[model samples]
Target: MNIGIIGAGAIAHFLLEKINRHRHENLRISSVFVRNKEKYRLLESAYGVSLYTDLEKFLDSDIDLVVETANIDAVKTLLPSVLKKKDAVLISVGALADEALLTEISDLAHAYKHNVHLPSGAIGGLDLLQNAHALGTVTSVSLTTRKPARSLIEEDIDEAKTVFEGTAMEAIRQFPKNMNVSIVLSLAGIGIEKTSVRLVADPHIDKNMHHVEVIGDFGEATFSITNNPLPENPKTSYLAAMSILGTLERIGQKIRIGG
Candidate 1:
């Protein structure tokens, strides 16, 4: 599997490290795509792979899969081209909250016969949520995400603050990077408009915490996860990068484990 990576941020660096540790002889990194080559000149020199700032040149590379570790806006801009040719793994799943964009991606991927993979990022029980929704109608879904106040903003907050409380769409709009898990649950269960979200900036907690609650005809399900922040980037969870790597490994394996 010849992989092409997008972005040169913390998640991208973490993913490259994980891939190197896997030592998968068949899986090779073909190239890297970034907006400004000058900014990541050191990364380009260190990796020894072809670095491209041009979209057309990157798309023309011999890449079987594209791993996107960039922001939601970058995903919105670059994903369509990748979806038209090769399969892609998107870490910034929040971009799919836009129904029109999601529809466009779906249509393009369908036209090209390519798959877009969304990993269970940072949180868990997504497989169960998807299966439950498939079997029966899910009445309600809510996500409560608690993270360090510093992660949300640079200014210090002494007490736990309700940073955002609204529909998934609003939360995504308010906190694009911090509340991606809410959008993930929304995609799996209801949608951005229907799925409720509560974002809290807690001064007491050092780690990022997510608590999801779902109610349906099937039953009631609740999941809570406390994730340590990535050392490279305090705004992101370490588990977020691991989840993508896990999905990549599963793609190469023969036996299926989850739904």
Candidate 2:
């Protein structure tokens, strides 16, 4: 599997290190695309992969899969074309909040015979949500995300404050980078308008915490995860990067597990 990565940020760096640790002879990084050529020049020598600052050139490379660890804008602009030629693993799941864009990607993938894989970022139990939805019983879905006040509102507060309470779509608009989990939950359990989301600014906690709940005729499900943020980027969960790596590792495997 020849892979192309489309970011040079914290998640991209961490993901690369994990890929190196679990080095697969078949899984190889063929190219990297970053906006800043000088900033990520080290990647060329470190991974022995071709690096390109140009999007067109990067897309022209011999990459079987393009891993989007970049921003939502990058996903919106770059991914549709990539899907025409190869499969993709999208970490910027929040971008799919746009119904038109999501439909466009789905159409392109179906037409191109390519797959777009979405991993459980920062939290889990999404398979349960999808399963419950499959039974036509998933009636309710909600995500309560608690983060350090400093990371949320950019200040330490006296107590935990409910900063935002709205639909998953609004929450994503409000906190584009911080609320990927809300979109992920929405996509799996219900549509965006029906899914509830709450963002908390908590002075009491140091970690990024997510509480997801689902209700249906199949029954109820609850899950909570306190994720440590990546060292280079406090807004991102370390587990999120690991989830992408795990999804990549699962590729080209003979044995399949879980939902």
Candidate 3:
């Protein structure tokens, strides 16, 4: 697996550390795309890999898969090229709220015959939702992201209050950067317009906690995960990086443990 990562931030560093620790076979990090080369040059030097401060130069590399570990805007920027190749996994799925852009990407993928990979962000049950959605109706899906006070800007948040409560479409419209889990859940079960979201900022909590509840014909499910923020990138979860590494491991070999 010759992988090209979009961001060399905490998620990139953390995932690579875990990858090196596990010692997987036939794995290579061919290239990385970072906005700031000087800030992230150490990673390239340490791994002995190519670094692309320029987006075009990075996309031209002979990497097999492009894993988007960057923020939402970066994901939107690199999506077209990744879809051109048909082997890309997008982590910042909240960026797909622009139905125009989403439709464009979908049309392009269908024209070229590709797959857009949407990972279950830090939370699980996406596989179940995907299957259940294919059958009957998934009536309700809700995601609540509870993060520390620091995660939100003063304008976007209230002190330990429910900052957002509406349909998932509205949540994605309002909180483009913060609430990616809503978009992920929306795409999996119901449409974004139907799914719902509740965002809270709790000063008492130190970590980013995600509580998800689903109600459908299949059954009802509830999942909660508290993600410790990465030391390097406080905006991202440590588990977010780990989840990307997990996906990369699964992509390489047939040692299928968990589906």
Top TM-score model: 2
| lDDT tens digits by residue: candidate 1, 155-248 | 7889999988999999888887777898888888888899999999899988988999999988999989999878888767889988988888
**TM-score, prediction 1:** 0.93
In terms of TM-score, which candidate is stronger, 2 or 3? 2
Q: List ranges where model 1 is wrong by over 4 Å.
A: 153-156
Q: Estimate each model's TM-score.
A: 0.93, 0.95, 0.88
Q: What is the lDDT of candidate 2?
A: 0.88
lDDT of all predictions: 0.86, 0.88, 0.78
Candidates ranked by lDDT, best first? 2, 1, 3
Considering only N, C-alpha and C atoms within 3 Å, which residue pairs clash in candidate 2?
none
Tens digit per residue, CA lDDT, model 3, 1-259 = 7878888767777766655434447667778888888887888667767889876677678788888888788767778877877478888888888788789888878977887777777677787777777775788888888877666646444458877899888997887877888888888888788887888878778898888888888888888898877788777777776667767767766677544
Instruction: Give lDDT for model 1.
Output: 0.86
In candidate 2, what are the lDDT values of residues 1-259, reduced to their tens digit?
A: 8889999888887867766545766677778998888888988878777889887788789988999999999999999988988899999999999999999999999999999999899999988899989967788999899988888787657989999999999999989988998888888878889999999999988998899889999889999999988887876788998898888888877897876
